[model samples]
Structure formats: C-alpha cells, structure tokens
Target: MLVAPFPPSHPLAWLDSHAARRREVGLRRELRPRSAADPMLDLAGNDYLGLTGDPRVIAGGVDALQTWGAGSTGSRLVTGTTALHDELERELADFCGAESGLVFASGYAANLGVLTALSGPGTLIVSDAANHASLVDACRLSRARVEVVPHDDPAVVDAVLAARQEPRAIVVTESVNSVDGGLAPLRELHAVCRERGALLVVDEAHGLGVVGPGGRGLLAQVGLAGSDDVVVTVTLSKALGSQGGAVLGPAAVAAHLVDTARTFIFDTGLAPASVGTALAALRVLQAEPDRPSAVLRAAAELADAAGVPAPASAVVSVVLGDPARAVDAARACAERGIRVGCFRPPSVPEGTSRLRLTARATLTDADTALVRRVLAEVLVPVAAR
Candidate 1:
C-alpha cells in the first residue's frame, strides 16, 4: 500500500513544489538507464582518448584488483595507502612535472579539498565566471572572499587582483572550459597571478590529456607546469579513461593538503583498480603520442560539420536555444544511433541550452560521417523551430 504523503507544513514540502516548477519549465531531469553494451556512437561522454576499453588499461586494473583486493580498505592516512597508490602518485607527479601529487576519491573531492584548504579569511579567490560547477561549489565551501571575473579575460583578472586588499590571493581557472571547450588565457593569467604574488590553481579536468605536446596539459604548454606557485588538479576518469582525481603541486603544498585537506584526511582512498588503470593509461599516452592529436582532429571535424568553431579541446557545443529543443535534439540523435549530451539550465545558462558532444580518439571515419548526418538532420529542424 502507498504511504500517506508528508504534511503540508513539513519542511520537505518545498521540494515538491520546486520539482513541479521544474517540470513546468521543462528543466526536470530523468535518469535514462544504459546497458553495458549500448553500441551507439557515443559523443556524450568524457572518454576523450578512449582508453577505458583498452586491453592494457583493463589488464592494469585487473592486476591491481588481484594484488590489492577491490577497495583501498581505509583512508589514505590510515590503511588506505597501498604500494600501487604510491607508485601511481609518483608516476603522475613525474609525468606532470610536479614536485608532488596527492590523489582524491573524485574530481569534485579534489577541487573541494584544494580550494578549501588553500583559501582562508585572509585570502581572496578570483574565479572565472564560466568555471566548472565543482569550482563554484569549492569557492563557496572555502569561506573566502571570491570575485568572479568575466570568463577567460585576464585583464579583468589583473584588475581584480590588483584591487584586492587580502594578505594572500589565489586565481582559479580551467585550462579548457567544460561548456564550450574554449581555451583559457593561461599564460596571461599566470603572469597576473605571479605579479600579484598569488597562487594560480588550474583545473585540468578537460585539458590534461587533450592539450599541449604529448598531452602534458595546458600548463606545460605555457611553461607553468613546474612553477612553484602553480597548482593543477586533474581527473583520471576523463582523458585517462580511469577513475579518481589528483592535485599536483609543490611538495610543501602537497604536504599541507595531506595534513589539512578534509576530503583527503577523511575520505576513503581511491581504489587500487583506478590507480593502476590510470598509471597504464598515462604510460600508453606516453607511448602513443598521436592519440591526443587524434582527439583534436575529431573535435575539429565535428565542429566543422556542425558549423561551430573548432574546439580547443575534445568538447564541442551546438546551441539549441531552449531546454525543450535541446532535449528533442538529443533524443533525435539517440533514435538515429548516436548518443549526444543535452545541456539545459543549471548545466548551462538559461538561454544557452545546447547539445554537448565530446570527440574521442577512437571514433572512426564512419562514426564521423554518421555524426555529420544525424546532427544535420536533427539540428536543422530544431533550429527552424
């Protein structure tokens, strides 16, 4: 039998009304079940390099699981740190040219951990207006005075930093923005941060394995990788096709995070399987330098077909104006054997709901042709409407 609903005066009653409002606005979200072998041409996911199904990556994960069991067993400070974890951290730090690296359970956790630990009452944080949601949430959680500058404009960033009276400050930016795949002015931002004696924290969640020579990342491209004041956070789940996140920085910062970062201190360590798979993926990336370039090529091709600017990274957005139109476009793609992402309000600004597609290195010419046809067919009707 169905239980009676909560009373009208109950605190949870507000959620029902809010949900109804969302439904009216076509902003309500639903979880669509996906099978393991969907066989659709997938452009909606973040597996840019397409290493998730690579045999070597799977082998690495299997080996680690056999050796370390499944879970990390405890938090890193307790029994969580395994030999594989140590090796992965060392390799990641070496690969990225950072003095030290620390792993977190998820990219969200890593962003939260670093931002909260680094910024305090005496510190000011200048964030880009179009930064990721994780960064936005992190800034809020930091309790620091955060000034959001115009997106990708380093001059405004400089002005804000110059006007700040805080004893210390940090500038946070994503190397490649998650929404439109536009590249940030990293060199200019770094210069501004350096001149202001502020730390530069870059989230390389999208750029780490899809930008720079051999995919070292945008910081490496701008010669800021090993800089003492530059800190980077990356997710193993995106380009690496693994799971977990890591903060790369100077040894002192890493040490401080270990002692002070609540996410690191309290959360369970990243699983051995993810750590090993990331290690394998990194090594594969080192060996197969063309994969990164292939990802770029695919994104460029997709953008050209869609009449959008070439993507700076693996993501490309096709604006569909409203949430309902965007959803229709995505569903149309699905019916045509393509899986495309639909971005509505909250994921994007109210007026810019779009079809967000990610380019994968593993996508074939046939896949490209199919995408071109499906997008042309679906987007035209949506655009006309």
Candidate 2:
C-alpha cells in the first residue's frame, strides 16, 4: 500500500474563496470588540431580566471563584462536578418542578446531549423545521430517521409520527422561536406526542425565567413540567443572567444521561462561578416576581415602537428584507448610541435579514425613548434605502 506524495498547497487557501463568496452576498461577519465601559444602550444581548451585573450576582460569582479557584478542572464524570453544581441542579429542578436535572457547559451542549442520548437508529426524530441549529445538528448526529415538519403545525407532526417506521420517536422544538418571537403550540404538540407515544423535548432557552408563573417556564404554567413524557432543556444565560444550561426530566432520565450522554460525560462541568451566579439570579427572580412582567412590557413597547406585533417573549424582531439593508439599519442604530443585533444567513433564512432587539427589565424611559427614536429616525430610513 504505497501512497504518493501530493504537491504542496497553502493549507488555509480554501478559506479565502469562502470568505469572498460570503462578502459578495452580504453574509460576511466579523467580531466587534466591546469595552466594559462602552456607554451604548444595549438591546443586542440576551439579558432579559437585567441581572447579569447585579451586585448580588457578582458577589455570588466572586465567592465561588475564591472557593473553587476559577475552573472545574475536569469533566463532570471525572472531577468537574462541585458542591455548587449539585446545589444549582437541585434548586433548578425544584424551581422548574421536575424530579431531577443535569447541568451542561452550555445550552447547545445540553440539546446535543439529550437528543443524542435519547434517539438512535431505531428512533424517529420529528423536529420542527424552525428548530435551533443545535437541535438540527443533534438530530443529524443521532443516526435517527428525522422528519422536519412545517413550523408550529402539530397536525403535520402528528401525521409524520404516525407514519414513521421506527419503534421509538421524539419531537423536538423550542418554546419560543428566536427569529419571529412566536410561541409554539406546546399543548397541541404535547397532545400529539402523547397520543403517538413519542417523547416531546422542548427547549425552554427563551421561555424560562421570562414566561409562566413566577418565570418557572411555559411547561410549568401549562401543568406539563414534571410530565413523564415531556422533557425540557433551558439555558441559564438568558433570563437567569448567568451561564450554563440544564435538562429537566425524571430522575431516571438524568441518571441515564450521566451514564450515557457524551456531551455531559465528556465536557467539563460548568464553572462554579456560573453555577453560583445562576443560583443567586434564580433567587432574585423568585423574590422579584414582577421582573418578568416588566420584561414583557418592555418587549411590547419596543415592538409597538418598531411597528411590529408584540412578541411572545422578550425578543422583538424587525425584518429588513435585504441583508445589506439590515446591516445598514443596524449600523444606523449603532451610530445613534443604540446597540442591536443584526441577523443574516445562515442565522436567518435568505432574504429575511433582520435586526433582533432584546428587551430588558432594567430599560428606563429614556432608553425606551431612544430606541423608539432610532427605530423611526434611523432604522426606517436605512431600511428603506
């Protein structure tokens, strides 16, 4: 078995061609450095409840750093899990009304962990066409027969699940679609899954700490939180104003994941700082239940100002049909001291570029006024251009 040596070429040359193609289509992206003291009004981040910089949350992180020495040191199955991790998992499960919970390094990993662990060659994964990329990637990695049905249509899901040849099935979706900020019909979806004997896995990344009673999540409000057939995954980074993610389900499911889920067993445990800050943030949410309402109100106000419908959650999307136009609109907002998120392909569908604004509970009246003015005087003209 003799192999001939090939002619030499620059190892990274292919990247230049790809970068040029992206630039031609207005899809190129670059990281913009942010300073700690930049005085721009922030509507670009996911801090829905505005607790990330809270003194209490900061103190929680500081204390954990002093105790845990900054890192988890190893994977959870090795030496990553700490007493803080255990406490956070227990409190998270209690808050969400689940029998048990397992923390992961990030929400993406949690999605991958659960989907890969639950489905395989003999499983059928019915995923929403508009599901987050994490779930989509997880399905591809699961070796399952995947069928993507129309967005928010439970009837289509039911039909697909009924026609699947696999013995075990699962339905994957998000409680709130990030781009359009529309709520999924979880009740209907749950009914279909239950009737078809399929497991329903809903990502509450945007729903937790922003929806439901006391911000427990949409499933809890619907009385489905601890249901045997329903599993929920949530991120602490959003309304919780921290980092890390968790999967909430039966104690049996958590135990199985500890033994089998690749992401959980192989990835480093979430840092003690993140766990502690998340715990403190959860307590803050519990104490100030009205914070969730404030976030909703802010979202509605922003949407109204932007001439869009009130969103289902704290995210409000303003669609600008062309990618270049959307980028210009975002830049105009930025020039006016407003920070907003610019979404283009493949983060969004082609020709549907948008400016994604997130509402915060801490937005003052002046901030709201500035956003309204930007939407009118800056964004409107740039989007038109």
| Model 2 per-residue lDDT tens digits across residues 350-383 | 8889999999999999999988888899766775
- Give the top-scoring candidate (lDDT): 1
TM-scores for candidates 1 onward, in order: 0.97, 0.97
Query: Where does model 1 exceed 4 Å of error?
Result: 1-10
In candidate 1, list every pair of residues with a backbone clash.
Answer: none
Clashes of 1: 0
True-structure RMSD, every candidate = 1.8, 4.2
- Give model 1's TM-score versus the native structure: 0.97
Whole-model lDDT, model 2:
0.91
Q: Could you tell me the C-alpha RMSD of candidate 2 in Å?
A: 4.2
Query: Model 2: clashing residue pairs?
Result: none
